[model samples]
Every structure is written in C-alpha cells, then in structure tokens.
Target: MFGVLGPNGAGKSTVLRILMGLWHAQAGSVTFQGARLPPPYDALRAQAGVVFQRATLDDLLTARENLLASGRLYGVRGPRLNERVTELLKVAGLVDRADERVVTWSGGMKRRLELMRALLHRPKLLLMDEPTSGLDEAAFRTFWVQVSRLRMQEGLSVLVSTHRPDEAQKCDRLTVLDEGKQLVTNTTAVLSRYVGGDVVTLEVESPDVTAAVLRASLKVDARVVDNTVRIEHPEGHALIPRVFEALDRGTVKGVTLRPPSLADVFFHLTGRALSSRVSNEPEPMTIRTEGQP
Candidate 1:
C-alpha cells in the first residue's frame, strides 16, 4: 500500500479525482501497466477501484443493488456477477443485510458495503480517499481488517489518501503533502527517523510560556503545538526528569514521552502540526510520483 498524507485542502481528493479521470488535470502524464495513458483516462478508470472522500452510494438503494449497479458498470454480469456480489457481501459480513437500504445502515456498515462494491469487479488497483473519516475505533479496525484480507487475497496495489496517522502507517511508502507540495517521500520508517529522536510533550497550564521557558532554560528546541509544549531531543529518557525539575510546581498537568511518529516528521519538515489546516489550492499534478509494489 502507498499513502498520500496531508490535512484538509492539501489536495488529497483533487489528486485522486484527477488520477481517476473524474477531474481533468492541467498537465502531466499517467502510465499504467507500462503504457502511457491518454486523455479521459478510461483505461485507468476501468482497471482501478475508487472510494471518494464523500460517500457516493445511493442511500435509497439496497446494499445488493449498489454492488449490482457497480458490477454492471464494470461489465460483470450473469452468473459471474451474482457469484461475485454474493462473495463480496459475505466478505463484508453483510449477507443478511444485503437486501436492506444503505440509508438504514451505520456509517461503518455503509463504508464496508462501499468497499465490497469497489472490489466487485476485481480491479487491479484500489484508490481510497479518507476511507475512515468518521469511523469509531472499532469500526476503523474492522474496516481495515477487511481491506487487508482483500488485498492479500487479490494481490492488489493500493493507493490511499488520508490524514489519519494510523492509516498512513499501514502503507509501505508515503508522500507527505503540505499545501499540495510534496514535502517528503519515503517509507514510513525512514520518514519517522527524520525527526532524529524522541518527542517529549508536556500538557501544561500555559503552553507558550512553558515552551519559551524550556527553550531559554534547558536550551532545547521546544515548540508549542496544539496547546502542548513539545521538546524533541535525542535522549528523551534522560531529559524527562530534568524537564520536571525545571518546571514550577503545578505548572504541568501531564507529561508524555514517546518515539517519533509521522506527526513528528511532519512538524520537523513543515514546522507545523499535521492537523493544522492550509488554505492553498493544489497546483495540477504537483505530486512527485513513485512506484507502487
């Protein structure tokens, strides 16, 4: 799996739409299966399954009806289509609910049905845009479990765009985008190492003041983000006690020490939190392309 990681207005949806040929790109070429694609991207669209950021299922349609509609678009029909739909519904654990309208289902169930619909034609590639946008922990885990199972069973090459760190971490490689610009592209492990150390965060009464105090007194590069005083250092284990000693009584409400994560890498590269929103419109085809296994 490969990931395009960024927050809102970072062009995740726009990029996916362009790649799927649902939206036109001002420039750039796309090569699929060793052949360069022409305008309209009919070939790419035909071979890849897509799940947009927004739900596209006709809520009034039955779960089975939705999958049947998608299968028809992909030219799967007769016994083959029936067998495929039945198999996918079973995989999604919605065989009993297949005849029910999608509007009556939970968000997670609808998302699962969407996935089943995407895979009904057995496409070579899967493109998902924020597949777990509003799902709870249980729902998110269940959804990804189905994805992992299907990928392994089908040997599919997947491309996903999401701001969720947990989702991005599942990818074999990632491209971090900020304001539509590719800030970095690498494997998640290599990208996480760019932070160079552990992250020590202090939930304090006054984040700015605490950050400034740590910078001046401890001589550490402390930054305030999301109302927390965060200090990134090579030896966080040794720095923790010193940090506590430096702070005044009752100033800190909580402290957390952990290894560097994707969020830390984003902060190191962009000087801002991954959750921070950017308003810039994406330049067409600004993506730095890479191979997907």
Candidate 2:
C-alpha cells in the first residue's frame, strides 16, 4: 500500500483526478503500467480502479444494480459478471442487502459497496481519496481490515490519499506534500529516522513557566502544547529525571518519553504540525461517574 499525505488545497484531489483520467494535464506526462496516457487515455483508464472522497453511487439503484452497471463500463456482462457481483457482495457483507436501494443504506454501507464496485473488474491498481473520510471508528477499522486482507489475497496495489497521519502510517510508503509540491517519499521507518531522537512530554501545573525554565536553565528548547511542555532531543529519557529534579515541588505532575512518531517527522521536516492542518479522531473517552473527580 502507498499513501499520499497533505493538508487541504495541496493538490491531492487534483492528483487523484489526473490518475483517474478525469481531467488531462496541460503539461507533464502520465504513465500507467508502462503505457503513456496523453490524449486518448484508454490504456490507463482500462486497468485503474478509483474511489473518490465522496460517494458517487446512484442512490436510486440497488447495490447489485450499481455494481452491474459500473462493471458494464469495462464491458463486464453475462454469467461471468453476475458471478463476480455475487462474490463481491459477499465480500462486502451486503449479499443479504444486495437488492436494497442504496438510498436506504448507511454511509459505511455505501462506502463498502463503492469499494466492491471498484474491484468489479479486478483492476491492476486501486486509487482511493480519503477512504475513511466519513467512517466511525468501528467502521473505519472494519474497512481497513477488509482492504488489507483483500490486498494479501489478490496481490493488489493500493494508493490512498488521506490527511490523517495515523491512517497514512498504515501504508508501506508515503509521499508527503505541501503547497501542491512533493516534500519527500520514503518508507515510514526511513522517514521517521529524520527526527533523529525521542520526544518528552511533561504535564505540569505551569506550562509557560516550566517551558521558560527548560530553555533558560536547562538550555533545552521546550515548547508548550495545551498544559504540557514538549521537548524533543537526542536523549529525552535520560533528561527526564534531571527535569523532574530541577522543577519546583508541585510544578511537575507527570512525564513521558517515547520515540518520535510520523507527526514528529513531518513537523521536523516541514516546520508545521500535521494535526494543525488535518484533524485526528480522538479515541472514545469514558465519562466519569460520581466521586471519580
């Protein structure tokens, strides 16, 4: 799996459009599977499966009818097409609801059916834009699990574009984009090495004061985020105890040190936070009962 990651207005959608033959570029050449896609972009379009950020299925059509119609674009018909539709519906767990109108389905169900539609012709590659845009946590997990398993089973190549860092991390490799330009393309492990060290987070009573002390007295460049003082250095774990000892009695509340994440790598390279541009789904937080506070 490959990932294209960037913030809004970063030409991510344009890239997907170009790859899908939706629009032709005035300049630059596009090649797919050793075939040049210039004007008559048939070869490229013939074998590429595309899933857009939005649901494009006909709401009035039944799930089976939608797949059958989509497949016909590639000249898929007869018993072979019917068999393929049946098999794909089973894969998407929509076999029981195959005859139901898509307008009656949930967002997750439509997305799953869209995926099945994409795979109808068994294209050489799959291109997805913000594949998990509207999925809840459980639905997102289920969708990804299905895709990953399908990739292994079919030896399919998937290229996904997403603003979510955690989602991008799932790819085998990624290309980071900013301002419609490519920043870097490499394996997750190699890109993460750019950080060169670990990250330390200190939950303190006074974030600004603690951050000021770290910069002036400890000579560490610490940044304050929310109520935490975040420090990134070559050896964060070793400096944790020193930080705790230097702080006032009640100032230091908690400390954690860990290796840098993909977010750190992006920030270190781009000088901008990915979370600031994109949003992350927070895990479900439990509500406090009486006396918990």
**lDDT per residue, candidate 2, 1-293, as tens digits?**
99998877777887888878787766788877776767547786788787889899999999999999999998899999999999999999999999999998988888899998998999879899998887787788788988888788777899999888778889999998888889999998888888868889898878998999989878887887645788888988788888877787778777888898777776777766666533336654657899987
lDDT of 1: 0.89
Candidate 1's TM-score reads 0.92
Question: How many residue pairs clash in all the candidates, one count each?
Answer: 0, 0
What are the runs in model 1 whose C-alpha is more than 4 Å off? Answer: 276-293
lDDT of each: 0.89, 0.84
| Residue 184, model 1, lDDT | 88
RMSD of every prediction: 10.0, 2.9
Model 2 / residue 181 / CA error / Å: 1.6
